[model samples]
Target chain A: MESVLEVKGLSKKYPSFELKSVGFHVDPGMVMGFVGRNGAGKTTTLKSILNLVHPDAGSVRVFGLDFMENEDVIKQQIGYAVGGVSYYNRKRICDIVAVTKMFYENWDDSEYKHYLNAFKLDENKKLKELSSGMKVKFYLTLALSHHAKLLILDEPTSGLDPVSREEITDIFTKLAQKGVAILFSTHITSDLDRCADSITYIKNGELMFSGNKSEFIRSYTESMGKVPSLEEIMVFIEKEEVVL
Target chain B: MGKLLKKEMKLTASPLSYWFILFSFMTFLPGYPILVGGFFVCLGIFFTYQQAVEYDDITFSALLPIRKKDVVKAKYAFVIIIQMISFVLSALFTVLRMTLLSEAKVYLVNQMMNANLFYLGFLLLVFAVFNTCFMKGFFKTAYRIGKPFIIFCIAGFLLIGVGEMLHHLPGMEALNSTSGTSLIQAFVLLFGIVIYVVQTLISMNSSERNFEKIDL
Candidate 1:
C-alpha cells in the first residue's frame, strides 16, 4: 500500500534540545496517532513535514513528492493545524476565511460555512476575541474546507471540551472512512484509542512503535497485565530504552 | 508564483500595519521637507517588515505550496508594494505643496528628486540589513543591531549635512550640481536599479540558505 506520508532520518539540533534521528510513515485510510511528551519533538516533526522547521538532515515525502522539492504540491494536499491556531487579531473570522479561501484552490466555502455554524462560531467576531477552543474549531474548519487528503494536527484537541472533541473526532472518522489519512498528534491516549486506526509513538526523537491500534493495545495489555495507557508505554520505553 | 503572490498579498492585507504605514507616510506633509518623508518611509518599512517576521508565520508561510524561490520573490514584491505606496503618497503631498505654496517648486522638485534617490539608497540598505539581520535566523540580532543601525544612519546623514555645509568651500557644488543633470540622473537611476537587483539576489540567496539550514 502506498504511504500518504513518509519521514526518514529527520534530525534537528538546538542549543538546549536535539531531535535525534526520527522516522515514520502513515498509509492511506489510517488515522496515525502521534504520541509524545510535551517536548519530545512531536511538533518539530510535524513542522519538518510541513517544511515549517528545516530538518538538519533527512527527507520528508508526502503524496509521493519530496516535501522540499515539491512543497507547494505537497501543501495543496495537506491540511495543518498548529496548537494555538492563531490568526490576525484584527481580522474578522469571515475575512480570515476569505483570505484562506483565496490561497487554497480546493477551498469549499459551503463546507467552511457549515463547520463555522456547527462550531457555533460567529463569522463577524475578531479572531483575538474568540476563546482558545473556538480558535481550534476555526482552524479545523479551515483545514477540512481545503479538501486536504491528509490532516496534520498538532495538539489540535488539547483545549476542547469533550463534546467538541467528539464532534471533531466524528469529522476525522468520517474523513478517514473516505480514505483520507490523518496524522493526529496528541498526548491524549484515550482520544487516539477512540479514533485512531493505527498508532505511532515517538520518544526523544525516535519512533517507538508504528502498527495496528488493536494489536498494539493488546500487546501492551498482555505485557503490563493491564491495558497500559499510551503515556505509560512511553514512560516504560524511555526507562527501558526499548528500541521496538 | 501566483500562489506565492496571493499569499503574500493576503498576509499584508491585515489593515493595521497598512494603516499605520499610510499614517506615517502622511505625517511627512504640510511643512516637512524631503528628509522627514524619507525618515517616515524608512520607519514604515522597518515596522511593517518587523511585524511580519514575528513568530512561526514565516514557517507557516514556508509550509504553503510555494517554492523557496517564490517565497523570496513574494517578499521582494511585498517590499516593492510598500515602497511604491509610500513613494506615491509622498509625491502627491509634494505636488500639493508645489501647487499651493508656489514659492519652492524648483527647489522642491530638485529636493524631491534627491529625496527619491536617498530613499532608493535607503531601500537597498534596509533590504541588506533585513537579510543579514532578520532573514538569516538573527531576528534577535536584528533587533539588537537596529539601535546601532539607526545611530549609524544618523551619523551618515550628519556627514552628508557637513558635506552640504562645505559646498561653498571647494568643488562640492560642482558635484552636487552635476547630480541633477540628465546623464548623471540616468546613472543614479540605473545605479539604484542595479543595487536593488543585487540586494534582492543577495536576500534571496541568504533566505534560501537560511531555509535549508532551519530545523523547523
Candidate 2:
C-alpha cells in the first residue's frame, strides 16, 4: 500500500524540551493511532507536519510532497484538529464556517450543516460562549467539511463526553471506509483499540513502535501472559528503553 | 496576494477596530491646527501596528497558500490604505474648517500642500518605526527591544522641535521660499527612505526566521 504521510529523522529542540529524531508512515486507507503520554511530543509532531512549528532537523512529507517546500499544496489536502477547543472568541459558528470556506476550495456546506445539527451546535453562538465539548464538535465539523484526504488530529477527544467521543469515532470509521488516511493522537487507548488499523508509539520524542494494531496486541499478550493494555505496553517499553 | 489581503480584511473587520480607526483619525480633524495632519497620520500608523501585534494573526497567516514576500507586501499595503483614507478625511475636514473660519483660502491651500509633503515624511517615519519594532528578535523580546523605539520617537519629537526653532531664523525663511531641491536635502531624503526599506525587508526576514525557530 502507498503511504499517505511520511516522517523521517524529525527533531526539534527547546530550552525545556527536546523532540529527538522521530519517524513514522501511514498508508492510504489505514488509521494510525499516535499513542503517547502527556508532553510526549505528539502535539509537537503534528505542529511540525502542519508547518506551524518548524523542525530543527529532518523532513515531513504528505502525499509525496515535502511539507516545507510545498506547504500550500500539502495543507490543501490536510484536515487538522488542534488538541483543545479554541476559536476566535467573538466569532459566531457560522462566521467561522464562512471564513474557513473562503480558504478551503472543497468545503462542503451541506456536510458542515449536517455535523452542526448532529452535534446540536447553534450556528449563531459565539465560539467562546460554547461549552468545551461544543467547541470540539465545531472543529470536527469544520475538519470534515473540507473533503480532506489526510486527517491529522491532536488529542481530539481529550475533553469530550462519552457520547460525543463515540460520535467522533463513528465519523472516523466512516471516513476510513472511504480510504482517508488518519493520524489520530490521543492518550485514550480504548478509542485506538476500537478504530485504529495500526498503532505508533512515541516516548520522550522518539518512536518506540510502529506496526499493525492486532500484531502489537498479540505480541504484548504473548510476552506478558495477559492481554496488556496499550498504556501498559507503553509504560513497559519506556521502562525497558525499547527502540523498535 | 489577493487572498491574503482578503483574509486580513476579514480578520480585521470587527466593528471595534473599525470604529477605533475612525475615531483616531477624526480626533485630528478639528483639534490643534499646527499638528492636524500629523495627528491623523500618527493615529493611522498606531492603529495598523496595534492590530498587527494584537491579533498575533500573522502566525496563522503564515500557514496560508501565500509567499512570505506577499505576506509582507499585503501588510504594508493595509497600512498604506488606512493612511490614504485618513489623509483624505483629514484634508476634507481641514477645508471645511477653514471655510467656516473665513480664513485666507490660498494660505489654507499652501498649508495643505505642505501637509501632503509632511504626509510623505510621516510614511518614512512609519516605515522606520515598523522596522525598529519588528526587526531581529523584536517580537520574541518585544517589551525589552521596544525601548529603543520609544526612544526613537522621543528623539524624533525633539528633532522636530529643533526644526521649528530653526524655521523662525532669518535665513531659514529665505531657504523655505526656494523651490529647487538642494542636492544635499534630496540625498538625505533618498537615503532615509532607502534605509527604511532595507530595514523593513530585514525585519520581515527576521520574523520568518523566528517563525521557523518557534516550536508552535
Candidate 3:
C-alpha cells in the first residue's frame, strides 16, 4: 500500500537550536511512534510537516501530493491532536465545536456525538473545566470526528495514568486496524510497545532510527547481547551516550 | 474564507467588541473630543486580539484546514466589519448634529472638532492608521500585541490632533462646519476612504506574509 505520509530532509534552524535533516514515513493501517527525550526536535519536525512552521529545507508529501501546494486538501484528511495548547478556554465545548465543524467538508456529527458520549465529555462545559487527560480526549474527539485518514498527535498520553494510557492505546490499536495511519510522539515507550507497529527515534535533532518496531528491538538486543524492552533500549542508549 | 470569518466572530472574538460599537454614540456628547469615540471602537477590537492570544486562538486556527493567509484575512475582515458598524453609527449621529441639533447652543459654541462629514472622514483615517500599524507589527511574530498597539495609539492620536488642527488653518475652516456640507468635506471623506482601503489591503498582505513564516 502507498504511504499515507512522507517527509524528506526536513530542516529548521533557530538561534539556539536546529532540527537537522529529519525524515520518516507512515503507511496506511500503521501506527508509527515518534520517540525522543525533551528538546529532541520532535515537535519541530511535526510542526514543519503540518506547515505550522515553514521548513528551511525539505519537502513533505501527504498521500503522494506536495504538502505546501495542496495544504488545505491534505489537512482535511489529517487529524492533529496537540497536547498542551488549549482552544477557547472560556467557551463551552459545544460552542467551540460549532465553530470548528464548519471548516470540514466531511464532518461526521454522529461520529462526533458518539465519541463525546464514549469519552463522557459534557458539551456545555468550558474547556478549562476539563482535566488534562480529559483535554487530550477532547482533542482526540475533534480529530476523529472528521474521519481523518492520518492522525498526527503530539504526546497524546504524556501525563495520563496507566489506566488512561491503556485506554488511549486501545483506541489507537482499533483505529490502526481500521486503516487509519497514526504518527504520535511520546516519551512513554510502554505505550509505543503496546500499539506501535513502527518506531522513529530522534536524538538531538537527528534521526537515530526509523523502522519496524521488532526490528529495532532485535537490532538493539543483538548489539547488547540480551533481550530488552523498548523502554530499556531507550534508557540504555541514552545512558551510554551520557557516559561517552 | 467565510468559514474562517465565522470562526473569528463566533469563537475567537471577544463579546466586548460588539458592545464597543456603542462608543460611536459618544458623538452626541456636547463638548468632548468626539474623535475619542473612534479610538474606543478600535480598542474594542484590540481586546479581541488580546483575548485570542490568551485562548491560543492562533495555534487553533493554524490547525484548521485553512491557509495561513486565510487566517489573516479573516481577522482583517472582522476588524473592518466592526469598524464599518461604528462608522455608520457615527455617520447617523453626525447627520443628527448637522440637522435637528444644528442650532443647539452647545454644538454651535463647541470649539473642538464639530460633528461633520470631516469628522467621519478623520475617524476612518484613525482606523486606517491603526490597521496599518497594528497588523504589520502584530503579524511579525503573531503574539506580541503591546508594542504594535502602543505605536498605533501614537499614530492614531497624532492624526486626530492633525484633524483638529486643520480647521484652525486659514484655508481649511470648512472642516469644522456644522450646518452645511461643503465640497471640501466631501473631498476629505473620499480621501479618507481611499487611504483606509489602500492601507488596509497593503498591510494585510504584508501581515499574511509575515504570519506564514511564524512557527505556532
Off by over 4 Å in 1: A235-244, B13-33, B54-56, B88-169, B174-197
Kindly report the docking quality category of candidate 2: acceptable
Candidate 2 structure quality by residue, lDDT tens digits, B1-216: 667666656663344334444532432232223333333344445544455555445554565555544655565555545545654565455344434532534444332222222333343544455445533444443223346446545645554454334434666442222232444334434664676667766666666555455544
**Evaluation by DockQ, superior candidate among 1 and 3:** 3
Question: In model 3, which residue pairs have backbone atoms overlapping below 3 Å?
Answer: none
Error of 1 at B145 (Å): 9.4
Model 2 spans with C-alpha error above 4 angstroms: A237-244, B13-16, B23-56, B91-116, B123-128, B131-215
Give interface RMSD for all predictions: 2.6, 2.8, 1.0
Candidate 2, residues A102-217, lDDT tens digits: the string is 77777888988887888798999987788766776676677778777888888888887887677777778888998889999998887886789999888888887888998888
Q: Which ten residues in a row have the lowest lDDT in candidate 2 chain B?
A: B111-120
| Highest-scoring model, DockQ | 3
Pick the winner on lDDT between candidates 2 and 3.
3
The runs of at least 3 residues in candidate 3 whose Cα sits more than 4 Å from the true structure, single-residue gaps closed, are: A240-244
Residue B166 CA error for candidate 2 (Å)?
6.0
